[model samples]
Target chain A: MALFSSLTPVFIAIICVLIGVILKKTNGEKEKRETKSKPLSRPWVDEDLKDGTDHHLEEEDVDEEWQGLDENVAHVPFFAERYSEGEMIKRSQMFYELLNKRRSVRFLSDEPVPREVIDNVIRTAGTSPSGAHTEPWTFVVVQDPYLKHKIREIVEEEEEINYKKRMGDRWVNDLKRLRTNWIKEYLDTAPYLILIFKQVYGWLPNGKKKTHYYNEISVSIACGILLAALQNAGLYTVTSTPLNCGPQLRVLLQRPANEKLLLLLPVGYPKKEATVPALTRKPLEDIMVVM
Target chain B: MALFSSLTPVFIAIICVLIGVILKKTNGEKEKRETKSKPLSRPWVDEDLKDGTDHHLEEEDVDEEWQGLDENVAHVPFFAERYSEGEMIKRSQMFYELLNKRRSVRFLSDEPVPREVIDNVIRTAGTSPSGAHTEPWTFVVVQDPYLKHKIREIVEEEEEINYKKRMGDRWVNDLKRLRTNWIKEYLDTAPYLILIFKQVYGWLPNGKKKTHYYNEISVSIACGILLAALQNAGLYTVTSTPLNCGPQLRVLLQRPANEKLLLLLPVGYPKKEATVPALTRKPLEDIMVVM
Candidate 1:
């Protein structure tokens, strides 16, 4: 018994050392996980911004079968309205001139835009292509002054944190030339605040979650079309991705859990004194490779 | 010395267990990193794709100062063209009608399109707004039949693997209704195959890597504008992300390592017998909510 008690001290010391090593390893693992989830390079990106695979991973225990169309749908013949080459050239050049005039105007006028125009442009965005025709987008058009202010508060609050704390010196320095800070007066001044939400997943008729593949890319493409529509209609807005404000905005708008905010555009006419950074686009040769 | 010898066996046993635990933890860490890098739910997404953070991680030892515009650029007064309310409504409706007519046409005609139109449409795409004014996009207009055919071969080979093996039964079954298969004859049939690449990062004048934030979303938006320009000029094309063909096509087209293929568009006239699935967009009310 005396010998065993003598050995207990050494055994306890070894156990203590082993436990310490294990504790350090576990702490390292947790730090690694945190870093993995929040990439250091792009700290401004919201944690909620993902490609819906996270949701899919959670629901993996449920239905493994894809609940898309049960049977093949019929295809109808498509006849395009073909324009003459000369006409095509003219139209293309004219369209380019019109769109080339587009600038991301941060200062918006409170002038009431035609609600019909906003409706038409949102409708135009709805026509964008999706992965397997899964149209996973929701357009929340907030015109109520109270809701607009609420959104502005949420955006400015998060953006202040982004600029001051989350976004490091490099990102802040990168945007120094653009003169963009957390102040978004346009959010309150614009006639409409069009907040776009990408539906990560949709419910099947049987109450199962159906994965919407490429939802972010799909919705962004649709937003592209929406931008064109807005420009074509002579509307002005800035395409802003509010950092870290997605979940709050999603909840503020009462959007379902499956929906995440992708973009927020305050649509209206530019304030008469609106100014944009004198930025030049890369020439066609610089941007295009003809091979 | 006699007592130490007696305890040696127990010490060795404890050491063995400690070593085993360490090995298991390390293995677990490696497995976790692998899973994090390649999310299982969206396995078909190319592994190369990332928001420029991977490159940033690699270059951590380099200069950390952002090499964007050193001096703040001047802001210029912006004046948008104002259209009458009636004109605005009419324009918005007309634009929607034109864009709504667009369908993803897989079957393309080999008829030569006006290269000027292609240039202008791309120019319009170039005018897209990007993060921090970093126009990170390359539109490779491939008209050469040989190169086009080479692209077709690469796409088809990858697509065959994707459809046959890479994509499991659920994905394949999901796409069964769309009638899409590994066969992509449009790669050869289209007069021009516009491969859009997002420049993930760019080299500064001082040879340091400049991060291009939101490059994927920016390029996709440019593509949206490109699609709109094509439609306005009565051109027909389909928006396709040829799965798993990004790296090969990038090398095939001689693009730089910093660029990754985002979308592949076959632009030309549609085949006479081009048929589209009778898909209807969600109505404005279904897609939009007013608050």
Candidate 2:
């Protein structure tokens, strides 16, 4: 009777955690659950992994299938039909409300945002699709005033050189309109800065193997999703690649050898009054050519 | 009067031809009038080719006052209100209508789509944002049965090795859920295969140089936009990057050295009967975080 009582408490605790986590993730799709027909025809569990009912792999790297086909033959492959060609798009209500309203702020309010916001935004970015599912990324949130200054100083040093020496007359001439400089004020002004990094191929978690595939696409997908999530959260962001601070900043941050910094985004509210360049977009007709 | 009439015909004919050529190059954003903030701000005009402007360079390379910024920098450093962040993020009627309905399709039909659709789609893809607006990309529409056969032959070769030999038990175990293999039938089954290439940089018409930034990011953004556009047009596509075909396909296509084949997407209709593996996305809590 005592053992049963103890077991009951543990099971209930696990259920509570699961519920909390589920609540955290569930969003616009809740209403569409019933409408979802299984989109695939292939068996969810491979014959090798199925142990009568459960679906996860029972063990790692157990490659028993020696199924081979002639490389030259263009055989018809299987495609499951859980999702139809026309109905896979799910416009998220939460994201739509948020991303549709997001504004890029050049001038920022110096007010510090709740740390919770920064952490959550980074967490959302971490869920992006990566090459070979490598999940090759790192997020460094800078809240320290001193570190912000240091980053700014290093970035400015490079910008000055670019403007003064490295950048050619043609390139500098093009940049003349927006009046951008190497000294990024947003780096210092915004309460938080999230630096995104893409890890090239790296060792597996077991530290025994190499992996391959397109990581750039995977990282960009994550970035796209991140942009949508941040906008939904009632914040402003600018995804800017800091060209000048590459080598120096990486050393300053002490990143791993395999990682390359992709973008340094400044996140916060716009200044009480801010102005963006009035840029025009190409017309839809110009972009779209329907047959 | 006769002299005037003769000049008018000649002038009008040249202007018409010029516009026809320009129109072909103008991706999507041509509908918006070029914002005329200043004559100096236009991207097309050669800044150095001054026609009695306030400052003409006599000693360009030696001039210390000239900011080290490249001459190209003057080409509208930022595309002014070309798009407001809000406008850029808003769901366009076409984009919304299409993106809201997008589904990834592994199923493909052998029925050939008209070359017109392929032409229009590739033209649209050209408008995608590129690194430094270099537009460093090439699309090889492969409908040639002979070449498609060659591509499938090579891709399967590596994939066969990956699935059976090189892939570890852990890697194999993780891949079981996706239910994919070295077997690729879509290459032949789809009516048209769109091969995307990333050109690192390009030469100007004058043989001067240009540089591209974040080429992969730029290319992927274009790909996302292209995918969204293609899906919106009621066409189906699946993005596949078979890096194994990088050398052979490039040689086959005669792409320049800098260009890398990144994605080989087969575009057409999903087969009446198609099957995909049973896969469920991670719950919202697992994928999204709230601050």
Top lDDT model? 1
lDDT against true structure, model 2: 0.52
For every candidate, the chain B TM-score is 0.90, 0.64
Worst 10 residues of 1 chain A by lDDT: A51-60
Clashing pairs in 1: none
Candidate 1, A1-291: lDDT as tens digits: 768856765776677567757766776797676457445555545677755235545545545576856656788999999889999999999999999999999999999999999999999999898887889999999999999999999999989988998877777898988889999998899999999999977888888877677778889999999999999999998889998899999999999998989899999999889999888889999999999
Misplaced by over 4 Å in model 1 are: A1-9, A12-38, A52-59, B1-30, B33-38, B52-56, B59-62
Best candidate (score: DockQ): 1
The Cα error of candidate 2 at residue B52, in Å, is 42
Model 2 clash count equals 51
Can you give the TM-score per candidate against the true fold? 0.93, 0.53
lDDT of each: 0.85, 0.52
Residue A72's C-alpha lDDT in candidate 1?
63
Sequence-dependent TM-score of model 1: 0.93
Candidate 2 stretches greater than 4 Å from native? A1-128, A141-147, A161-178, A201-213, A224-238, A244-258, A268-291, B1-105, B109-130, B139-179, B224-238, B251-258, B267-291
Q: For residues A1-291, could you state the per-residue lDDT of candidate 2 as single tens digits?
A: 646644554555455555544543352244233122211111111221111111112111223332221123333344432333223222222222233334445676797666655555555555443443446566667777888889889878877876776565555654554455675788889988777665543454445423323444656655654554455445677766665466676677777655556666788777766664333333334333221
